[model samples]
Target: MSEGLEESHQLFGRVAEEYDAARPRYPEALYVALEEQSGMRLAGARVVDVGAGTGISTRGLLDRGARVAAVDRSDRMLSRLRARTACGALLADGNDLPFRDGAADLVTYAQSWHWLDPALSVAEAVRVTGPEGAVAAWWNTVDAGKADWLAAYQVRLAESCSGYVGPALPGWSMPPIAGVMAAAGLAVRETWIGWTRSVRLDDFLTDLRSRSYVARLNGHEVEELVNRERAEIGRVFADGRLTVPMRVYLATGRKSRPGGG
Candidate 1:
């Protein structure tokens, strides 16, 4: 990966607490879809969640009775994960996971794959996953161009931040995953699940701070942007809260089984 991309992954550590407090959680429907795709029930699956910052995704797997190992490169982020959950937290890179070959029934990357080189990360995933086991990656994006206020706020951010494409916002498309999985010798499947979350205005603002683009801002710029954004949000949402419509795009594929299909 480029230095800037690597730096963006590390940037979350600076606001680890806020990230844990504000980043959206994965909907249970998405997890169910993943389980279906992998043909592995969550209740007994041995899962490794790579780039599992702050235990958000790890906790979800654990909640469904999976035994999960949460892996991340940032000690600060891992510390937050450990504080919130009992899952094993491994400080490691996605490209170089510390797992025995074929040790995991399923390996996952949630909202973190952009930090990795897909070639290396997918290879590592394939190595750690048992025959017929799966690798899944997903991101929580806006469901549609439904939140105009949020759209305007993102525009403000784009205007302020250099070369910011706002991938976290609505309308930013992911590259084709079929070719990516094919290169790893896996058959890919894709799914989408829609969900909604409502948050207080302050929490909504803090969530923006967790983005690499926004986190790149200087303090003065952030404060000014927050003030402007808060007003825009207020104009659209009454009662000091906002409802966010979100869609999770899940791409999953299984490792080739021995004596393959």
Candidate 2:
């Protein structure tokens, strides 16, 4: 891994608890869409959830009846995952999985794919899953266009946060996921799911702080940023409540079965 990426991973390890408590869960519809696009049911499927930080996605997969192995490089993150879910939590890296060939019926990355090297991780995902098995990845991004306050928030983040790269807001650039999956000999499909959440301003700020970029800042810097954000948001929401819009970008790729279409 690159030095910067390694630093980011270490930062996430330090804030695992904050991340688990504040991050928003994926919409139920995203899982439904995953099954539809992948042509595979989660019920009873053997799944390897790569980059399974804090088991947020693992719990969801488990709820859908998937037998999931939650894998991450950070023991701190995996510790949180193990504490909350009964799934097998493994200390592993996505770029180099420790599973045997065809060991999984499906492999998934939720909100964590961006941290990995797709060229290596995509191939590893394909190698571990059986023929016709699927690999799915998704990210929940803020729909800044849906609200004026959110748009201003993005602008503020862009100006003040050194680690921020604008991923939380709409129109941010993403890696070429479809291209990488196709190169790995899998058929790829993509979809977007839009949703909204009503959260207390304090809780929303907590969620914002959990963002990898924001979490990496020093304590005083983070506090200053949060205070400024609170004030700006308060101006828009005097009641200290916010209706945050979200968009889930999902991509599912299925390996072709031998002697089948």
Error of 2 at 228 (Å): 0.6
lDDT string, candidate 2, 1-261, tens digits: 353644646878888888888888899999999999888899999999999999899999999999999999888888989887998888978989999999999999998777888699999999999987999999888888788788889889987876676655456665568888988889889999999988899888888888877877789999999999999999999999888998999998998743477
Off by over 4 Å in 1: 3-6, 167-171, 175-177, 256-260
TM-score for each prediction?
0.93, 0.94
In model 2, state the lDDT of residue 115: 84
Error of 2 at 148 (Å): 0.9
**What is the Cα root-mean-square deviation between model 2 and the actual structure?**
2.0
Error of 2 at 253 (Å): 0.6
* Highest TM-score model number: 2
TM-score of 2: 0.94
Q: All candidates' lDDT scores?
A: 0.83, 0.87
